[model samples]
Target: MRRALNIKNKLSFIDGNISKPTDSFDPLFTPWEYCNDMIIDWIQHSIGFEHRLTIAHADIATNVWTDLRERFSIQNAPRIFQLTKAISSLVQNADSVSVYYNTLKSYWDELEIYEPMPLCTCGSVKTLTDYNHRTKVMQFLMRLLRLYSGSGSSI
Candidate 1:
């Protein structure tokens, strides 16, 4: 949504970079209102039917955007737990190397979305990312069949 708004050059409507003009006499008031209504329509069209009412009374694009973000950006504990359990219990079993790897990668990708690494400017983020990569590699190796374990064979 952010990317689409940016592409349309309307991100300012919801990003707080531009504010609605207060004076009716101001020349920018008309154009700003028009753009705001357009953005509101785009947001409403993009969201689900069940969520439309939550922002139906919103008069500003920023308010609508904020309400939607607050409503949907919460961390879901049950989903995170499910993903973790699945990753831990997964094994190569009878699947080919590529199939097993792809399945594991998919799980990992979803888990990352739920539990994303923190960002900072202290340079610790790089170290943490490296550690995470090494950990994932180990987990993948640990789940492989006995024949492939420590065999040094190309995947």
Candidate 2:
């Protein structure tokens, strides 16, 4: 949702980073208003009925988006704990190696969505990403059963 808004260059409206023109005579005012309307419409159509009713009285897209984020985003400790618990409890069980890995990957993907990697302003994002990648690979290898691990020399 945020990616869609950002692609349309309407994220500023929802983030409160865009300033409204003081006068109706301002040339950018109309375009700004139009963008805001487009964002609000997109948000309304995207959300569920219960969510819509909660933010129905909101005069701007920013408020609606903010409220939705506050409600849905997993920034709380309980959500984090739950995800970590799932990761800790995961096992091969009856599933094949490929299926088990995929199941684990799904949890990691969701966790990534909740805890996104930061875009480094210091031009170290590539280095950071590579490090994160290696860490995840090592973690996955470590979780695999010894019977399937084959030989360490092969690595």
Candidate 3:
């Protein structure tokens, strides 16, 4: 959704790109209205009516998205605690190596989605990417079962 909007150059409208118009119809009027309509339609179809009501007054896609994010993606203490507990208790007993890794990756991915790493104003994310990779590597090693104890000591 975001990629498509960006490709259409409509993303700026939602991200606070404003312009002053002297006449009734501004140059950005049509496209901006189009983008907002599309976003509202998407929200209505993807989310139920109850959720749609919360964003009904939002005139721009950004406002609607921000409201949705605040309602759904405000990661708090309890969610963090649950994710940490799940990560700490993960095991690789019955599953194959690939399965175990995939499961762990899913949890890590969810954690990331909820608590995204901070990015600079210039959009640089290298540090966050590297940190996530290192954390995943360490998690994989730490969760190995007792059968790999001898091999683990070599590391």
Candidate whose TM-score is highest: 1
Q: Give the per-residue lDDT digits (tens) of candidate 1, residues 1-155.
A: 99999999999899899999999999999999999999999999999998888888789999999888877668879988998899889999999999999999999998887789998999999999999998888878888999898663453
Residue 138, model 3: lDDT of: 79
Clash counts for all predictions: 0, 0, 0
TM-score of model number 1: 0.70
Candidate 3 wrongly placed segments (more than 4 Å) = 18-28, 43-50, 72-75, 113-135, 145-155
Give the CA lDDT, 0 to 100, for residue 36 in model 2.
77
Score candidate 2 by lDDT: 0.78
lDDT: worst 10-residue window of model 2 = 146-155
45-120: candidate 2 lDDT, tens digit per residue: 8988777777666667787787888887757677767877887777766777798779878878888878889977
* Prediction 2 TM-score vs. true: 0.59
Query: How would you encode candidate 3's per-residue C-alpha lDDT over 61-149 as one tens digit per residue?
Result: 67776677678777677877888788889989888878988988888888887888886776568867787787788788788877875
Q: Cα RMSD (Å) per model?
A: 3.7, 4.7, 5.0
Candidate 1: worst-modelled 10 consecutive residues by lDDT: 146-155
- Please identify which of the two predictions, 1 or 3, would achieve the higher lDDT against the true structure: 1
Clashing residue pairs, backbone N/CA/C < 3 A, model 3: none
